[model samples]
Target chain A: MSAPRPVYDPSWDRANPNEVRRSIRERGYTGYTAGLAPGFVQANICILPKDWAEDFLLFCQRNPKPCPLLTRSDVGDPSLPALSDNIDIRTDVPRYQIFRNGEFTEEVTDIRSHWRDDLVTFAFGCSFSFEEALQDDGIPLRFLANNNVAGVYVSTMPTEAAGPFEAPLIVTMRSFTPQNAIRAIQITSRFPNVHGAPVHIGDPAQIGVDLAKRYQNVGDPTVGEGEIPVFWACGLTPQFAVMKAKPPFCITHAPSSMLVTDLRNSSLAVM
Target chain B: MSAPRPVYDPSWDRANPNEVRRSIRERGYTGYTAGLAPGFVQANICILPKDWAEDFLLFCQRNPKPCPLLTRSDVGDPSLPALSDNIDIRTDVPRYQIFRNGEFTEEVTDIRSHWRDDLVTFAFGCSFSFEEALQDDGIPLRFLANNNVAGVYVSTMPTEAAGPFEAPLIVTMRSFTPQNAIRAIQITSRFPNVHGAPVHIGDPAQIGVDLAKRYQNVGDPTVGEGEIPVFWACGLTPQFAVMKAKPPFCITHAPSSMLVTDLRNSSLAVM
Candidate 1:
């Protein structure tokens, strides 16, 4: 890997999605984009070649909770006009992960050098939007306070297969008191595009998870006293499917590095 | 005390609330009224002397989940115009339970002979409204199929009290698979007037329920192997408070002998 590059610029602290994209496209901002352009929607980026886009789209359609498609770019197109006016699929995202034959190839700040005419970009809604909604409603999320994402677990449950894209269901768990858990469910149910509510709650073992171990060690899974763990369909689920499918080529946003969009989080609420 | 008086007339089968009330008013129907007047709202009745009405009203307001007031009659007025047209509260309900000094005295088909000029009547939203919604959404309610109501339990949690009313919160339990339990919460959340959503789910012991021993033996509480017990605040909660208050005189609907009203159950959905 090349030397680590700064991912954030303080000048873009309160920048809007367009402003953030300008900095990312100019190669000034290349780090994780978790808090940048707050109140706007940030999406998980997945760019599959046109040959594989059909199967991936079908896969996403079948498993909407994990892969809720926000917008899909036409073949050979680099811009997602629906999400942002100038969202260049190759440069708007801070960091991108490249894979070849289901194997990790390398990470790059800009995919301009690797851009292909056959590339088709698909943006899926991420949990950040709903998490912001929860916090706005006075629901405290422990992981956010601890500067971590939700802990992920690969459940034994299988996802419906489309072509070779099949893998165990991936889940992310957050702990909350029973009362807050109910409130969280109600709040998240409003934003169906962003995973929408929880897939499982209460017993972790019931979903084939051991509380002590998480797939990526992304967040704290302590599940403190009087708190129950609620699991949501994770955005990483599609990435897992790509790895299992062993497509000739695949591209995705690196962990915590997302494509900030012009869409307001509030607009995503179905209610 | 008195040998059972027939509560339903065959002619009243599939009748509207007004039709059913007409037969009930003539003292020809005096049995349980469940499964009658299918689409209309049926309420749990509570009648108190004017002096005790204020405190009971406050209690119901403070504990809305349990004592959701559908409508309360004006003092000494036999008509509940808000619930139905040309209806008389004193004679509308199928059977009335008479209490003296907070102790059950007897059951009567009508309360005209015992009515005092200062009497006040309160009608609370019952689970039947939301249960109908649940069944309409294709959620199978096992207890309903068995001709029973939900199992009842008195939780150790104390309810907010008013002047002379203070008692433990009473809950009703229903069993559903995890998937259906989540759907149940969503469906019921729409009808706030009729106990919305569930207060607790999963382990019954977490809420002080043994499952093996229901409070009144009202229904089958046996949770199937994969089903979990979900508990909702019961309308009977206020009756428990009345039992503690020991008012000079009180009248309530006999079990399953509700006051059928002209209000359509669909009208209660806040959404």
Candidate 2:
């Protein structure tokens, strides 16, 4: 007998986090998880062989603002029960990017073939979690409207190195009126696990960022009249460190494809 | 017979807040209250006749960022028990500025001779309180080092008008490295009774400020290399509002001559 075909359900957008993960695990949903399971935590997933896990963990600890480590799975364990009840690291994320010695190898729907007894999974809080917080506080995020809410820049600021991991800090910029910028700082400050407060504000040039020059243009780059740019530590920072570390084997969620978990975003607030 | 002369002891600087008030009240100490009662709350005093009290109260409510009213004495009452024990508003402050119909009339060592049955005392939290908090957190105030830690500027931003009270907001500028500036905002935000967070940061021109031309210069005007100017709503703002309001009679503490209270500065932290 042939296996039944997986059906994509539009209602999944409004479904619970568990349902969203179920669809992704079953191969029914393979798209970016940006707005899915709103209010729940979406994580940036990074997997490495057991030999390189300790150094990567130390890297995150040393450079917490950019790589806020939320939880890590037991060595050789594929489950992150601390984050959710039914997480299977090999199949939960919608898409995975495979890297071999710092070079992009391929993308895959699931990592069952890559799962092994010598692997460790590390999950870090993503900036997407704090965007919900900023929005809830009435701070407007431009990328929400124009589909490009931020301009990515590699700051001259160097990350504190741990073991072999070292890289320039990557920041994502969002412009707001000075008034709203203060509110943004206050709101994001409550969620340190998700980047926590701005790393720097005002004078992008001080951080070696040229507003007109963006490393990746995923959002509108315009700083509106009377609006000042506020920059936050981006989750891409660890991926950069990983690239420079050149681990023998690594797995991460494809850019924009995150691990949607049952944990609520508000639960991440330190306050 | 002549009254006994009060002893002058240099150790009064380390004395308790109430002792400092006693020294000032007894004429043993009649100098600026800065660096005295180091950890206590120092207040900005505004005494108005009962007829003008209501309007001034409304003015404070309308412009809380600049006029964070901490306590108010009942009409005809000279005591501010809310701020300390044995508190007599007429004698606690070191010096008084008598204003008649919005014009400066005279300065006095004590207000007992000027105290009246119709007088109402309003004590607002002073920036001196938050300066302590900032210093405790290791954010340096330049004015503290050179005895010119701040520059007072009259900004183009207008206060919310209440009754006859309305004037351009008065801001105090303090320069810091961009990093320490963010820390200053976070630390000051904890004491809303004080000015709270800064009203404006960066680009003094945006707020109609010319650093070289301060309304009153108490500190260096230089914005050093790699340093940005941060402006906080000054206690002087309410004094400016009172000046414009033009009440029939009002009394305020002389510049830098403040009321030292028993309340600890740390007690004012909201978080």
**How well does each candidate superpose onto the true structure, as a TM-score?**
0.94, 0.95
User: Could you give candidate 1's fraction of true interface contacts?
Assistant: 0.09
For candidate 2, write residues B116-216 as lDDT tens digits: 99999999998888888888888888768886558889899888888888889988888888778878888888889998998888788888988888785
lDDT of each: 0.86, 0.85
Count of residue pairs whose backbone atoms collide, per candidate: 4, 6
Give the Cα RMSD of candidate 2.
3.9
Error of 2 at B176 (Å): 1.4
Task: Report lDDT (Cα) of residue B59, candidate 1.
Answer: 97
Model 1 chain B worst lDDT window (10 residues)? B1-10
User: On a 0 to 100 scale, what is the lDDT of residue B240 in model 2?
Assistant: 88
**Model 1 CA lDDT for position B204:** 77
DockQ each? 0.45, 0.52
